[model samples]
Target: MTVMNADEIRKLLPHRWPFLLLDRVIELKPGVSGVGIKNVTISEPFFEGHFPTESIMPGVLIVEALAQMTAVVYCTGALQAMREAEQEVAATAEAQLEPAEEIDISSRVGYLVAIRDMKFMKPVVPGDQLLLKVKIGRSVGILSKVNVAAYVGKVCVVEGTLSVSQRP
Candidate 1:
């Protein structure tokens, strides 16, 4: 149950400031599911124009945040699988040597190919802590189907399924 901060998340994802939405990944299960957080603030650039009088976080950005969280889960799972494979090889050879360096997975970030049954029940505003959760429902080759949802406390803010295709 390793936790990933912004720095570690950046290593696995290519998104930068003003774009990268994940604030912290609280829990991750390799090749399965993950839970994360996004702290919304009034300072966000989108809030400026999204509504001059009444600010609300855009629904699209919320979906994008879920995608980023999916990247964390997906890439971390791959990295873990790689390391385990390396360990197996090392054991078989009985080599008195350290495992190789961690693979650079920065470019492994995938593209969001699809979103299905998306729903937004409430608006996200400043001072809200958006909780993001995602589960990999199915994976075939380099493509995956992810079930995603976001919440503010116990209230569901958004729910949907997204398809991701890993970068080769």
Candidate 2:
């Protein structure tokens, strides 16, 4: 099922055109995990200079796509948690106490602090649709580790571990 389209994704993420790597999120489990899709096309600006004769999607961009997917998973999860917390607080509040203001979790941005064990097995070219998968790992304090992978059909093109942290 399509959990989030490009329009919805834009509301959760800050990335804009030409930079937003994900086209649609086919599967999402809030903060736990998610799968996103990106359709690479010849019309992409990077293709013009990456190789004028033969276009190839950069390996770094693949990694960036993976990171973006991870962000969506983590940030959305945080937003959900915040909403639940607010609800709980409201339910338990006394009549004399005023409801607390809503926190804008959407404004929180996650940064890729570290990327490890990255391996690119094949080159991604135009016309290929990349499937990005991200799963959350152990989290300590404000930092979280996620297992990320990118695939074209059944072939794994990129795989790595990404460490992400939210900015206060």
Candidate 3:
């Protein structure tokens, strides 16, 4: 298992700023699975308007963090497959210096298809460090299902099923 700091995470996911829910990737097994962390703070942008005096991290953001972690797994798997495909092509066929200019229409193969059976078990408050675990559940052609969970220490804060499709 390899750990990815925030910088590496930024390279993998397109999210930025207060929208980037993942603070760091705690563990990553490349194409197989990954886990990430999100630190809740009073200074978080949402808390100000959500409740000035007594604020809590929104349940939706917790879910988003879990989703982003899941997406990392998806991107990793797809990139690995893409690299393998390229290697196989290079090995068997004559290599060309010219790259495909069409933006590789196959890149849109991955997209989120569904978010199901989501449950919020507890409130995630300021100063809480959320640990998110996401794993590849099943794959049917270009579609894949990922099971995800978020925890505050030993307590489960949220859990759900995330379905992703490689077909545009």
Question: How do the residues 56-125 of candidate 1 rate in per-residue lDDT, one tens digit apiece?
Answer: 9999999999999999988888889988988888889988876577677877778988999999999999
Models 1 onward score TM values of 0.93, 0.93, 0.84
How far is 157's C-alpha from truth in model 1 (Å)? 0.7
Q: Which ten residues in a row have the lowest lDDT in candidate 3?
A: 100-109
The models' CA-based lDDT, in order, is: 0.91, 0.90, 0.81
Residues 33-84, model 3: lDDT tens digits: 8888898898899999877777988887887888788777777777777778
Task: Sort the predicted structures by TM-score, highest score first.
Answer: 1, 2, 3
- For all the candidates, what are their Cα RMSDs to the real structure? 1.8, 1.9, 3.1
Tell me which residue pairs clash in candidate 2.
none
Distance from true location, Cα of 132 in model 2, Å: 0.3
Q: Per-residue lDDT for 138 in model 3?
A: 77
